[model samples]
Structure formats: C-alpha cells, structure tokens
Target: MGQSFFDEQRDQSLVKAAIVAKYFDAWSRVMIANAARGIRISRLAYIDLFAGPGRYKDGAKSTPLMVLERAIADEALSKLLVPMFNDADPENVASLQSCLDSLPGKERLKNAPLILCSEVGKDAESMFTRARNCPTFSFIDPFGYKGLSRGIIQSVIKNWGCDCVFFFNYSRINAGINNDSVRHHMDALFGSERISRMRAALIDQLPHEREVFVLEELAQALKELGAEYMLPFRFRRPDGSRTSHALVFVTKNPLGYRIMKDIMAGESSTEDQGVPSFEYSPADARCPLLFSLNRPLDTLAGELLSRFSGRTMSMKSIFESHHVGTPFIERNYKAVLGQMEVQGKIVANPPAQSRPMRKGERTFSEKTMVTFPSRAA
Candidate 1:
C-alpha cells in the first residue's frame, strides 16, 4: 500500500493534499507577515515524514513537490521556506530527490530540500525532543499507526508558531485498541493512562458511541499536550461502507484552527442538515437521503440565539466563540443566521440589498454585524 498509495491521486488523497497545501500556504503567509512586524516567528518549515514518491505513475504530483512548487515561485518563501521530505523507503527518497531537483528555481530556495530515508521510530529523536528553529508545519502521514506518538505531536506544537497535521488511522486504531500485539504502539499514540481509560470506556459502547469516545479522548490528550486547537477531518471508504482514516490538525492558535476549518469544510462530501459533515464520502456524493429532518444546524442556530440573546456581535465573533466543539464552520453559522434573518428571529446591519443567495435564499457572512433580539420573535 505504500507505493500504491501514490499510484494515483484518489478522492481522499486529493482532499488531504488540498487541506495540507492550502493551510501550509495560509500559515506561512501569516507567520511571515507577523515576523515582518518583529514577532517571534523568524522563518517557516514544511516537513513530511511519511512522504511517498513525489509523483504518481500518472504524473500527478504529491505534497512534497506541490509545496516546493509554491516556494520556488514566491521570492519571499524561497528565502525562508525550509522544505523537508522523508520516507522510510529508499526508492521513494531517491525519486523525491530527483523530482525536487527538477523543480525550477530550486536554486533560489534558502535551503535545498532535505530528503531523508530512515525509519521514523529510530531517526525521529529530535522531533520528539528538540525545538525547531522556525515555526514548523509538520505532516506526519504514516500508512498505519506505527510511527505516530503523542510525544511527536507534543513536541512540534510546543513552539509558539509551530503546528502539525497527522494522519490518524482510525480503522487501525479501533482494531488495535484491544489487541495485545500492538498495545505499546497504541499506548505511545495516546499515552498509557489515556489509552487505558479509552480501552475501559470502549467496552459495551455502540460503534457510533465508540467513535465519539475515541475522538473526545484524542481531544483531551491534545489539550493535555498543549495543543489548544485540534481539528479532525474524517474520510470514509470509497463505497462509504465504513470508516477509512482521518487527518487531524493540531495547533495552539485559534486563527490556525479557523483557517484549517474553512479548508476542511470545503472538502466535505456530505452536509447534515446544511452543516458540513467534515467527512469525504464518495459513495453518496450529495447524500440527499441522509439529510433527513434532523436539521442539526437548526439546533445550533437556536443555541446561538439563546447564548447571545439581545446582544449584537459580528458573525466573525460568533464563529470564533461558538465553533470550538461544533462541526459548524463560518459558512454553516452564516447559513443558519441567514435562515434566522429571513424568519425574523435576528437582524443584520447593512442588510443583503444586492446579490446574495443560497438555494435561492439569502446568506450571511462574517463581516455583517448582526443583532440578536432579546427573544426569538
């Protein structure tokens, strides 16, 4: 599966690349801009520990080359971008180095791409202990649950501006939770104490309940490790029969969380009652049958109304405050707010006078200052 993973860019793979590249670009821009004003951030780095071959057999480029392409084109990034690619496979490292060598303007890069071939468990000592010089963005995408550990994440995110996005193989973990053979790996991933609690809790729970439990446990572990924000984007199998894996992004910055949320929301293949599902399900592209009358966003909308009753605030403020534990993104909040507006529940300053429509109805945005009535009218 390692080599075949880069066979061709599938839906989930495409989504992963999109999320990582887009967020990396956004993260670099912010950190660089902040550094200009004498912020603590001095530079930026992009590390892909499980980086596969740079391109697919069909000539599709993977994340490593995609990121280097961005650096080669931008003069500022070329000067500050530290591009590093590593894979346990020697063949992959060779191929990635060759592909990276072909990138135009690679010479302008401040540091040539650092390509490595070594076992992550053996060679990643510095990653688990040493502090990075710059604000590093790490993509730890292991095929299974072998090399990823809580300390690996705990280390990367300790820096002021550092952040990490790792592949969380849920299916592997769910199967390994009780299996004694891989107990140590699971222990390392979630810490021994946390995994013990997780194992005890998983007993007698339904499948759905188990999923929620594990996710909550992960959130708790991330918090304990100093990751203030952890966002998970799940990917279902092609047939949508069962879960496949997920990409979990962790950061200490709320702004990073917000930027990554928008990126993940865009790739969601399904939306429940108008809220992005945050999972890619290729089987049911539109998932019309599943949207049933649950209208999850309606509940969220009401909760917001009650929480900030009679108070005026920007949509941005509402999103920042209300979106931490919820699946609703800024767009989802805007959708529900637009519904409330049309129903006379809330009012928006500088109302939608011009082009604005979603499913032939008006929508809201972050900039629009909105006022919630003292009570639902």
Candidate 2:
C-alpha cells in the first residue's frame, strides 16, 4: 500500500489468486450452463502470462498452479485435449515443476501441457499459435504494463479465439501520465499517441474525471482488440484508504458479457436482477451495489457531490479534487452525472478552460463543470 515492491507483490498475488478462483468458478458454471443448453465444449485450454512462484511466500497456493490442478482433476474439464501453464521466472518455473510433480498423477502432468519460459509473452504467443484451433483463456497479470503490449494482445485474441481477463494497474498508469519522466513509457505500453491526446483531453475537459478517462481508454483499447464487452471491478484495501487492485474481463461474445453481468450480479446478491443496473440518479433511491469490495461507486459519488454542495462542477476538477481512480470514476461518475441530469438536480455547462497549475514553463488546464438546478427547492 505504501508503494513498496514486496507489499505490492503480496497484494497483487492475493488479488490475482482471488480473481483466478473467480474465473475458475465462473468458467465451470459457464460450462455447466452450456451443457444444460445441449452444447458441450470437449476441450479447454488456459494460459497464464505472469505465472509467479508456484507457492506464495506465506505458503499459500499459487493461482496458476491451482487452476491447473483443478483442471486436471475435473473429469469434465480434464476431458479437454490439454491445458498449458506458463511463467517467466526461473525460480517459479522450478517451483511449478516441483508442485506438479507432487500432484497425485505426476506422470499425467504431460496431459496438462505445461510450459515455462523466461519470456512469458513470447511463449504465450507461441503457445497460442500451437493451440490456434482450440478455445483458450489467457490470464495477463503482469507486475506492470511492460509484460503486455497491445500488439501481443491483438495477436493472441485474433490468432486464437482467446478471451482474456487482465489486471490493469490504473494507479501506475495514472501516475506515469501525470509525471513528465514516464510520458514516453505510455506510448510504448499503449502503442500510440492517442493516450497523450486522451490524457490531455481528460485534463482539459473532465479534469475531475481523469480516472474515468483512464478506464474509458482502457475499455476502448479492449474493444479495438475485438472484445465486445468488458467488466471492470475494483478491489480495495481493508482500511478503505485506496483501491488496491482492478480487474477487467474482455470477450468478443455478447453471451460472455451477459454471463459476466449475471455472474457478477449473483455474486453481489442482487437476486438475479436482469442486467446489473447502470442507472444513476441524484435523489436517494436504493444504493446500487458496486462491483468493488472496497469503495462502492455510489458512496464515493454521493460523498464527492455533497462536498461540492450539489453545485455545478467540471468533470476534470471533480476527478482531481477527490483523487478517485479511473475504474471507479468510469464505472460510477458518468452514471451519477446522468442520473443528476435526468432528475434535474444538476445541469451541465459549456466546457471552459480550467485554472492553470504552474510547473516549470508549462500550464495545465481542465474542462467539465456542474451547476445545481435553478428551480431545486
């Protein structure tokens, strides 16, 4: 939480492990649903791009290895041709081998089709090429953005109809853009100048919505990669001080979106409500559940709006003022704005240049504002 590498690593491992389990459960449920509908997927393959050590330092199990073990033991999933496990760390590779060896059927490890490499992205690409004909799911959980590139993702999804669930470090990306030293790093990670343009636009138009801009840009990139739908979820720390993690699910299938929304809804205990409602309104109605375990969007938005005294404010200013991260802003702020506009509780003003912040020879400005309804009692 304090930006320490060990702390970050530990937090990420826990979040990734939980996410891996969520997907495993979701995938199993999906398979069961398909079978109920008379459709059977005889083969299933999984790929982990950043498969870490096979065991956590605390002796907790590794997510990638756990998934492999479950797949091997599940008669339904084991019927699949084979599954693949990958990691970039040599120690992790050795650890994974040891763990697999200790499993019930050591010799049957071959059936799982495990591969360990120093460069997981390259290996993942090669693995995708080899399994081009089979349905695959790839988990891209890098320590940072360097391990995954837009091109590599495009290749994997395009070459093999693979669906990806990725861990996007919004905080890191935001910090990178805000700081001048890492500006060039953005182009390398995102593969375009558009990120700069969007960053500028966000700083200009909806300064308060900087986090929203990041989420939108990320979702748009996923769309460009051919994923028709995405589900973004945030994980928070226990103290509720900050967002520790964010997960995004990308798939080209509408059914995948429907299923994800349904699964998320069920997980939220929302009682099988149609699609997870995205509706937002200023008036107090039942608070809709946010996908995050920490900061619910409604709570954040309400608190922020109240702080502004329900006055009209620009999106950019709002984002900067609250320090809300991108995932939260994108998923919740827009809906809150939409609800306020509909209820006539607030009105949007024409975009205007934000007050400048001076640093060196440059001036930074933002656009986006909100005004309270004139007739509101």
Candidate 3:
C-alpha cells in the first residue's frame, strides 16, 4: 500500500513541532532582549516553508502558527510597522485563515499580514522579496529535504539576509545515501559533487556521527548562502533515547549568535548529567521543557548579568533593566542569583532600616550586588 498523506508517525511530527516551538520561544525572548537593548525592528517577517495544518491531529501543539500568534500578541512585536506570515499547505492556509478570523478585532491585525501559497518552490522567492527590506525569520520545516530547494533558500537569504531556523531530516537522508538510484536526487538537494566527499567523511564515523556530517554539510551550505553564524541543536524524545530532530539556526547577525549560544547553554545546564541512556519518556523529562521554558530565562539572565557586570545590581534594578515582568523576575531571580553566588561573582548585603530597630521591627531588606570576577583570581 502507498503511504497515507497523514501517516501515523507520531514521533517525527511531535518532535518536530516541539523543536520548532523551542526556536520560536527563543526568538520571542531574543526579540524582548533586543527591545530591552533599544534595538528597534521597524518591520519583521515570519515565513514558514512547509507549514503543516497549523494544528496537529494528535492534539500536540501547533508550532509556526502558534509562534506567529504569540509574537504578534507581544506588545514589543506589535510596535513593529510590519509583520508578515506565509505557509505552503492549503489545509494549513485554511487553518491559519480560520485562526485569524477568530481574532477579536481586524484592527489588531492590520500590521500582521499573512499569505498562503499553493506552490512553495515557485512562491517562496516572491514572498521573501516582499519582505526584503525587513529583518525576517523563515522557518523551513519540511517532511523531507525536497520542500526547500537550494535556489529558493539562496534567493530568500540573498534578498533579505533573514535569520532562519531549518529542520533537517538527517536520519532520512542518511538512510537513503547508500542507495545507487537516489544519488541524483541527493546531488540536487545538496548541490555539489561533495556528496562523494560527505560519504567518504562518514564512512569511518559511527552511525550517530554520520548524522553530524549531514548537519555539518547543511550548515556549510547555509554559510555559503551568506549566513554568518550557524548553530545546530539536537532534540531527543522525552526519555532521552534517540535524537528525534535537529534544529539549525542560521543568522547573518552577531546578536543572533549570542542569543543562540545562550539558549544552547541553558539547554545544556538543565539536561540531566550522567543519564544512562538517550531513551527518554515524553512525560517527566526536563529537556523537552528546557527548550521551551528554561532557555528564555537563561538568555535573559545572561543578558542581565552582562549589562550589570562590574556593578552592584539590585533585584528591582535587574528587573527594570531587563524590562521583564515581576512574575518572570521572581521565578528566575533566585536561579540567576544562585548561579552568580556559586561562582563567587556576586555579593549580597542586607538593606539598613532608616529608623532604629525595635524587637518586632524588620531591620534589613534583602539586596544583592553583582560583580564580575577578577582575571588574576
């Protein structure tokens, strides 16, 4: 029997959405961070190359659409003069249209534009052209490697120099690499005689290591297309058993690299050290939530620390400086403070009372001073 259009492949679909959401969350936090730094993005565009049905059949979260909505609702993002969205699938287009229709007001969506395309390969370039002058973000989440052609990607990045997050299916590609019949297809996708070179490089490596070669080749391809910094993040199932997906971020800007590093570092820190197997349960896992939750806090905390380096920073000062809400500040405050304390990088002092202390009077308030460590030490 031929494969169904809606295959019951829960693992791949769920993992892909989860990973895409992670990058979306990272993008949100980075936008917030940029705003805090007074970096104004007059316009921003989000393009999803292989946008799915917008919602999952398994009740798993919607990714590119959800991400777009979240960003649009964010006050920081709303200030942008333009925000555009694009998707390839007809079902997805209907889904997004329905979603947009349900919004309370059309005025709220005036600046938020969306386009649905029947043919992605032919239309992606034109969409990018429309968003050429803006700082754009394109999410390329294809089932296989075919949805995004080299020429299409080259055109988008060349015109917009946009930041991109791509889902590369290394497992599928690796599985087909040794087949004699598919060599031409692989050559078209990879756009090089370097397939032979890549195969040679992977011959001596382990099965797992071969995946890394695919990722590296993809990264190299993006770099050749003008993305200055490329970072690949691997995502596994909740039980940590096997790598389910790889999220690759390509950016021409230094700040994108900084944000990606912070997000990756946070993910690493939250990961359980010395775990026996990569096998992970979708439930009761930290890494899955790490990408969604802790990564933002990690990025925010790092930014806050960098801004206040060599200076005493109060809790209020930190919150104000970062433009973060009180709840977020409270939840992550101690974690950042604790991390700084462990490194002996911050000092805490009790605030003195203005009046004389009585038996029931609170004599001091908790305050913290953060400072960078001396190089000689």
Candidate 4:
C-alpha cells in the first residue's frame, strides 16, 4: 500500500511529541542560564529542517511549534530567539506561517525574526549553512532516511556552538540497505562505503543488537566528526523486544550533553544504563509516566561505585565529569556518597563521625574528598 501523507501520520504515536517537549524546555533553560553567566550576548537560533504544519490531526503540536511555545513563554529567550522552520511541502510552509500568526504573542516574536522557508535540496542546504554562525539548536527530524545525509549532519556539527537532535530512521534504513536500487541513497545517508561492512557484521548478531550496533556505529561516526558527547535515546516496542527508531543527540558542549541526558532519563522506561527505551501509548498502562523520576540515582550509584572504587575525589569533581548525566546532580551525588559512607563502602574526609551532629547531616561537599574502601592503600 502507498504510504499516507506525512500530515495524516499524526495518529501514529505521541511519544515523539513528549520527547520533543522535554528537550525544548531544557534547551531554553540551559541557554538562558548560559547567557546569564556572561557567555557572550548573541541570538539563539532554532531550525527544524522537516517542520510539519505546526499542528497534527490529533491536535498535538509538532517540533517547530513546541520550540515556538518555549520561546514565547520566556520574554528574555523570545527576544534573543531566531526561529527558522522549513519543509519541502509548500502547503506545510503556509500552514506553519499561519499557525505562528495566530499565536498569542505573535507580534512580540516578530522582532526576533521567524523565517519560514519552502525549499528542498541545495536551497535547504543554503538555509542550514546560514544558521552555522551562531549558537543554534536544530531539530533535524526527517520523515525518512533521505535528506539528512552524513555530509549535511557533519556540516551542522561543525558549526560553532551548534547542537543537533536527529531522528535516526533505523528500521527504514535497515530494511532498505541491502537493496541494490537503494545503495546510492544509503551511501548518501551514511557518507561512507562502510555501511555494507557494518550491515554484514550485524547479520551475525541478535535481532535487537543489530539495531544497537548500527546506531553505535553512527554515533562513532559523529564522534569522529568532533561531537564531544553522543547520547542516543531508543524508542522500542512495548515488550522491549525490538527497535523502532532512536533520537540521537550530538553536541560539542558537555553541559548540553548533561542536561539532555537528564531529560531523556526522566522520560525513559527503565532507569537502567545507557540509552533509555520509552513508549508513549495512551492506552498502554505499562508505559512510563511523563514526569516520573525513575530512580536514576540508584542506577548511577552502582556505576559510580564500580568506576571510582579506589579513587578519592570531591563531590564537585564527580559531578563535573563527562560521565555524569540527568540521573543525579551535585546534591544527589553527595547524598548517595553519604549513604555509601554510612554503609562502610567508602570513607569521607572531614569524617561524618568527626562532627557529631543532627540527623541527616550533609556529609559530602564539593571540597570534601571521598575514597572507596575497596581502593588499594
């Protein structure tokens, strides 16, 4: 059967909208905080390469509109924001523009500039390249695996202070990779001839691992392109048996990586390790709730104990490391460390025993160092 129009695919799932909302809120807060820290005054840009018609048939807001909502909510952010929404469909472009015009604070956003472009191919490339000069958050969510070639992603990744949250169309790409007719498209998508070899390697693996293996390779490719942090959020079947697709976030900023990790963790089904799996079916009672904090500290505790066994480090040091994500912040880290100390797993400096005091005293501070008892003396 021929595929339905992209606009009509609204009934598919609401999981994507939830994810976009969480990330958009985080992006605005992070940018505002960064600006407050004297991080050079400049405009913030949001580009949605495959922007839809702002609203779905189910009356849900798409990526572009969600971003617009965030900007409008914060006056400071709205003033510094530059929104560029584009789609290949001219009908979509018109609809998106009309949607913006109808917004409550549409006049306020006018000064910040909202560029709606109806272009594809080179014209689209030119639009993206223009956003390269400033700090930009791009939502490169394409319907299929066609437009976002590796080269295009690389160009955006190379842009100064640019962070991308891309939709990796794993199922589509995996199904089409072996077909001779789709080889050129695959080459363009991956920006390499190594995909064939990569696919061959996956054939011997388990069904689930096949999806993960390809995504890991894609993450590694982006890393080679200079993404300091690469985090992938997996959206799998409700039973957690196979994969659907993944939202791959690539960035050069450590702080951005940390914030995004926390946001994804909050949205994940299991607070285990690595990329979290989430399903947002309204009728499915098994799906994780939207705002639940799924005990990420417990997950981080085991990893921290294992990785930092013998080392003595300050709470600040551990919190500032690249390894720390949304599961916990400085306060949570200190509390966990204190719990470990009480359990005789680690020793704390300025010893908790030294200060005989009230119950639930704050035991670990950024200055206080901790050493695991398991470490070599």
lDDT of 1: 0.78
lDDT, candidate 4, 1-377, per-residue tens: 01222443353334565566677677767777888998874777777776777777667777777777777778888887778777766677787787877877766664444545543466667667666676777777533434556667677777656888877666776786677777766676654557767767876787667776777777777777677777777665545455666788888877777777666666665533233434323223464453245545566667777777778888778778625434444556777777887887777887887744546585566787878656454
Q: How many residue pairs clash in each candidate?
A: 0, 19, 11, 1
Q: Write the per-residue lDDT of candidate 3 for residues 174-244, one digit (tens) a residue.
A: 77677776665566556656677787787788866776677778777677777676666665544555555
What is the per-residue lDDT of model 2 for residues 70-135, given as tens digits with 9 covering 90 to 100?
A: 766665666563566666566677777787677664344336556666454465667667666656
- Candidate 4: global Cα-lDDT? 0.66
On residues 93-168, what C-alpha lDDT tens digit does candidate 1 reach at each position? 8888888878887788888777767666656554433337678889885334366666666777898788889786
Winner on TM-score (1 vs 3): 1
lDDT of each: 0.78, 0.57, 0.56, 0.66
Tell me each candidate's TM-score. 0.88, 0.60, 0.61, 0.79
Model 2: residues >4 Å from true position, as ranges?
1-15, 28-42, 106-110, 142-147, 158-161, 178-185, 202-208, 262-377
- Point out where model 3 deviates above 4 Å: 1-42, 58-61, 71-76, 79-89, 117-119, 142-147, 155-161, 179-185, 203-205, 237-241, 264-377
Error of 1 at 231 (Å): 1.1
Our model 4 lands, by Cα RMSD against the true structure, at 4.8
